[model samples]
Target chain A: MTVFRTLAIAGLLLGYAAVTSAQSAVDEIAKYRQQLQDGNPADLWEARGEDVWKQKRGPKGVSLERCDLGLGPGVVTGAYAQLPRYFSDADRVMDLETRLVHCMVTLQGMSLADATKRPFGSGTNRSDFEALAAWITAESRGTKMNVSISHPKEAQAYRLGEKMFYFRGGPHDFACATCHGESGKRIRLQDLPNLTEKAGAQLGYTTWPAYRVSQGELRTFQWRLYDCFRQQRFPELKFTSEASIALTTFLAYNANGAAFNAPAIKR
Target chain B: MTQPRPLLLVLLFVLGGCATPTELDIAKQAHEVMRASFKETGQATLDRLNQDLAQSACSIPPSTSVNKEIAATIEKENMASIRYPADGKLLGDWKSGERIAQSGVGKQFSDDPKNASGGNCYACHQMSKQEISFGTIGPSLLGFGKLRGNSEAIQRYTYGKIWNAQAYSACSNMPRFGHNGILTEAQIKDLTALLLDPASPVNQ
Candidate 1:
C-alpha cells in the first residue's frame, strides 16, 4: 500500500511539473497580453468618448468644441501631449481629467457634483470622464510628450509633485519612491517603474491611461493616482486635488520626449 | 600632477552654498502642498502624514542613499520597541501560523475595522516549501527551522524580528507588523513558529 501511494504521488508530481514547465505563468501572461494587444477594448471607449465630446446634452446644451486643452480651442489632436500645463485663466495646473471637468462645468453647464458623480466605471456604470479622457489621450497617441514647466506655477507644481513622490506616510511608511524609485526592481512580478529618471519615467508615464484588463475599465491618470494612494495606505486622494495635479505635472514633464502610446492595454 | 587651485576651490564652494536654499525652499512647498491635498477616510487619518524621526530619516529622496548613521539610529530605536510575550512563551501552533502568513488582508482603509489583522508574510516571503506561490520581496525561509534550529535565542529573535522588522534592518520594506499594531502578539507567535517549529512545513 505504501509503494502504491508513493507511486501515485510521484505520478501526480510529474504531471504537475509537465503542466507548469510547459509554459510558466509569466510566459502565459505575456502571451495573453500579446494576444490582447491585437484588439484592445480601449478602441470602444474612444468611440464612446468621441460621441460624448461632440454630442450636445448638458443643461447648457453646448458641445465641448470651445473647451481649450492647452492647444488653442476645439483642437483635439496632439493637445494631450502638452497638458497638465498651466492655464492662466484658471491660474492652476490641470491634468486632462480636471480640464475636462472644467469644460463640463463651464461649457456644458454641468454642476461639479454632477460632472464628477461617476469618475470610474464598474460593471454596467460607464464613466463619461474616463471615456472622454480615453478619447482625448488617444488623440495624442504617437506624438512626443511636450509638457511645459516654464510658467512659475507650472514649475512650482513640478517641484511640489517631486516632493510628494518622496513623501512617506501611513502605517506602512511607504512613499511612492519605496516601490518605484530604483531601477531594475519589481514587486512580485509587477515591474515598478523608477519615476525619477528619463527612461523609466517615459515608459511609466506615457503608457498609462490604459485599459486595465483585470478591472475591465478605462483608467485615467487621476484614477491612477487615486488608486496608488490607496495602496500606499494613505487616505483617499481628493479627485483633481492640488497634489494630484502637481504629481501629474512632475511625471508628465519627466516624460517630455517619449511618444504618447496609450490608450494601451495592460494586465 | 595638477597644482592646487585655491581660487577655483573658493568659486566652487560659493556655487555649492547658493544651491542649498533653493532645494530647501522647494521641499517646504512640497510638504505644504501634500498636506493640503489629502483627506481623512475611515482609519487613515490626516495624522498619518506626520512622520516620526525614523520615518523622516528613512524617507530620503530616491537620488540619495540611506545614511548609514541614521539607519543605525533607526535600527536601535526600533529594537527598543519589541515587546516579548509576557509569559515568556515564544512558540505557538505552526498550523495557525500558516494561515497568518498566507492572508494578505488588513490595515488598508478598505479593511473592516473590527476584523483581526494578518501578517501577510507570503506577500514578500517564501515561508514554506509546500506553497509554490510566494513573492520575492524578501528572502526565502524554506529550511528555516532546519538551518536556525529550535534554540531559545533563535525563537526569541524570530518573534522579535517579526514584531518589528525595522528592529533588525532599518528602513526595511517589510511592515512593522507588531509595532504598528498590524498583528496581535498571538498572531506574531504563530508566525514565529511558522519559521522555527520543527513540525512546520517551512522546516520540511
Candidate 2:
C-alpha cells in the first residue's frame, strides 16, 4: 500500500511535468487522463460507502442491508447492471440512485426531504447517495449490462427517452442529440458519444457514477443528466424524476451486453 | 446514418405487435413528460419547452433532412426577422466581442438572470488563432476580413448571418443570437466588427 501510494504521487508529479512541457493540449489532456486511471480516488468513496451501508444511523436506526435492489434483498452483487428496472413496491421504473433514495425512505424511516436534502455532495459534506452509488456500482464491475425492457412501463420509458433525446427547445435550441446524436463530434477537446447507437451507448452509459477529479465529487448518473441539461441551457433536471429514469432506461438498454465499469474516474 | 429506415421499420413492426405508440404519439408524450418533469428555475421557464417551427424542423436526425422548399421558407422567414441597427453602423469594439465569444455562461438555471448574456461564439466556431480551445462544431472564422474584404455587401451578410443564422443557412446549428434577444443590436455590431475589422485578432 505504501509503495502504491508513493508510485501514485510520483505519477502525479510526472503528469504535472507533462502538462507544463509545452505539449499539445490534446497530448497533455491524454497524459493527464492516463495518470488519473493509475489510482482512482473512487476507491476512497467506495470504502466510506460500505461503512455507511452497514452503519445503523437513520431515524429507524437500521442499516440498508434489506434494500431490494432488483437482485432481492441484501444482494449488492451485480445488482446495478440490471437497473433501471421496474419495482412493484415503487410502482415505477427507478435507476440505482432512485432505488437507494427509496430504500433510505422506506427502510430507514427517513423523511423524503431529509433523505433527498443532500443528494449531491459539497466540500467536506459528502452525499450519502454518492458514496452509496460508488460502492454499489463498484460491486457490479465486469458484469454485463442486462437492463430489462419487458414491462410496459419500461418500454414506455425507453420510447419516451428516445423522443427526449431528439427534443429541441430553449433559447439555444439544443437537444441531447445536438451534442451526443452525431458520430465523431466533440465539444472542444472532449469527445461527444453518439448515445443513439450501441457502441457509443456502451462507452457513455456503462461508465457513469464516476469520480470527477475536476469537481472533486462522486457524480451519479442523475448528476450527469443534471449538468448536461445545465449546459444545454435548459432548466434544472430534478433528481430521481421520471424524466431522468426514462433517459437512463434508454441509455442503459442501448448499452445492454457491455461490461459495467464504474465508479470510473473522469477529469 | 442509413440505419434509420431499418430502425424505424423495426420499431413499427414491434409497435404493431405490441400496440405501442406511433412517432407522433411518442413526441407528444415526450412533451408531456417534459412538462411534468421540469420546473421553472431562474431564467429557464417551463415555456422554454415550447418549440417554434424552425426548432422542431431542425430537431430531426441526420438521416432526415428538411424538404428544400420548407428549408427555403424557413430561411426567408428568418431573414425577415433580422433587425439591423437604426444608425446603420454595423461595427463596434472587436475586443468586447472577443470577451462575449469567450464566455459560455448564460441561460442556464444556475446563472444569474440579471447578468448580461454572451454570444458564446467560440463554443462552436474558431474565432482567433490564439484561442486553441475553440470548438469545431461551426466553420472557422479566422482571417474573416482578410479572406473576404469588408465590402458593404460582405458587412451586411456578416451582420445578418450573426443576427439570425437560420436566415443564411436554414436549420443551422448556430443559434439566432440577435433574433432570440441573446445579444443586443450593439453586441451584434461588436461581433460583426470582430469578424469584419482587419485590426481584430481574428483577421490578424
Candidate 3:
C-alpha cells in the first residue's frame, strides 16, 4: 500500500508538470499574437487593396468605385458583414471574393479568365483578390455579421453549404466537421474551432482574411476554403465557385450576431 | 489501395439514408456543387469527391444523423478489405515508427505523392508520454502495449485497427491509413510496433 501511494504521488507530479508545459506553450502563443497585433502586415495589403479598388486600369478604363457590394454601388463600409447575400442582378448568392470577381468582369471590363488568373499568391507574387479582400473586410472591422437568407436562392445556398459542411469525401474521408465538430480539440497544438456552435462559429468565421505569418500573405476566406480542400486531399477548390460561396454563406450566417473583425494576424 | 468494392455497398448506403427525398436532393445538389467546383491539382483529382458506403453513411450534418444499422454493414465490408502483411510480420522497428508518427507529410495537394507518406499519428494522438506537445483529438496511446499485453491476438488487432479504423467503428475519424494507401504495409507494420512493442517509448 505504501509503495502504491508513492507511485501515485509521482504520477501526480508528472501530470502537473505536463499541464504546466502545455499551458506555457498556449500562453506563449497568446503573447506572440498580442505582440504581432500592434503592427499587423495586413495594413500593407489594405493600403494596396484600397488603391486598386479606386484605380482605372482595366480595358474599359473604369474603377470599381461604382461596383455594387449588395449595399448598393461603391459602398465599402460594413458591406462584408452582410455578404454571401443574394444578388438580384447576378441572380445568385455570392461571397466577397466572387462579388469582387463579378465587379472586375462587369464594371472593369476584365475578361473572366483575366479576373481570376491569380486567386492566390506565392512569395513576391501578390493576389489582387487578397489585397481587395483585406481592404474591403478591414472596412467592416466592428460591424455585426448579419448575413441574410430571405430569398429562395439565399436559402438554397445556405442549405447547400450546410450539407457541404458535413460532406465526407477524399482520400482521408474528412469533412469540415471532422476537425471542427467538437469543442476543446487540438490538431498538433493548433486549436480547432467548433463551427457548429454559435461562439465557435462566430469566432472562426469573423477572423478570416488574416495575415498568415508563416506564409507572409494576407489570406482571404476564399483562400481558407481552397487551402482546407487541398489539405483534405480533395481536388483544388476553384478560385471562387458556387460551392465556395455556399459554404461561406453557411458559415457567415451561422456567425450572425458576432461583430465581424478581420484582416487580422495569424501564425 | 482498396479492392473494388462490391456493387452492393452502394445499394446499402442508399438504403441506409433515413432522410426524406428532399434532404437527399439537397445532399445530391451539394455533391454536384462540389464536383463542379473542384479541379484536379497535384495528386488530388476530381475522383476524390466520390464517396464510398461509409462516407455517404457517415456524412450527417448537424441537423441530421447517421443510421447505426448501416454501420455494421460498412464495418463488415471494411474489415474484409484489410489485408494482413505478406510475411505475417505485424511489427517493425519502433525507432522508424517514431519518426513516421512525428512526421505529418502526406496526401495534401502540396505534398509530393511520389514520396512516402507519414503516419502523422502525433497530429491527432498522444502516443508517447515524453512528447509533451501532443494533440487531443484522439485518445492517448501512452503505455498501450503495457496496458494491453502484446499477445499474438493483440498484435493482429493493433495492425488491423491501424490499417482501417472504420473496420472497427464505421465512422471513426481516424484515417484509413493502410486501406486508403496513405501508409504502406511496411510503414503500417512499423506503426504497429510503435503502439504495441514493450520497448517502444509509447509503452514505456
**Candidate number of the best TM-score:** 3
Record all residue pairs in model 2 with backbone atoms less than 3 Å apart, i.e. clashing: none
DockQ: the better of candidates 2 and 3: 3
Best by DockQ: 3
How much does each candidate deviate at the interface, measured as C-alpha RMSD after superposition?
6.1, 3.8, 1.5
C-alpha lDDT values of all predictions: 0.80, 0.82, 0.86
**Residue A38 lDDT in model 2?**
77
Q: Quote the chain B TM-score of every prediction.
A: 0.84, 0.87, 0.91
Q: Give chain A TM for each model in order.
A: 0.90, 0.91, 0.91
Q: DockQ of candidate 2? A: 0.42
TM-score of each: 0.87, 0.89, 0.92
Candidate 3 chain A lDDT trough over 10 residues, lowest sum: A1-10
Q: Lowest-lDDT window of 10 residues in candidate 2 chain A? A: A14-23
Query: lDDT: which candidate is best?
Result: 3
- Residue A70 in candidate 2, Cα distance off native in Å: 0.9
Q: Which ten residues in a row have the lowest lDDT in candidate 3 chain B?
A: B1-10
Candidate 1 docking classification: acceptable
**Tens digits of per-residue lDDT for model 2 on B1-204?**
011233433443353343234766777678778878888898888878877666665656651366565577678989999998899899999999888888887888999978888988887777786776666677788898899999988989999998998898877788788888788898888999999999999998
lDDT of 3 by residue, B44-82 (tens): 878788888878778885312556667777889999989
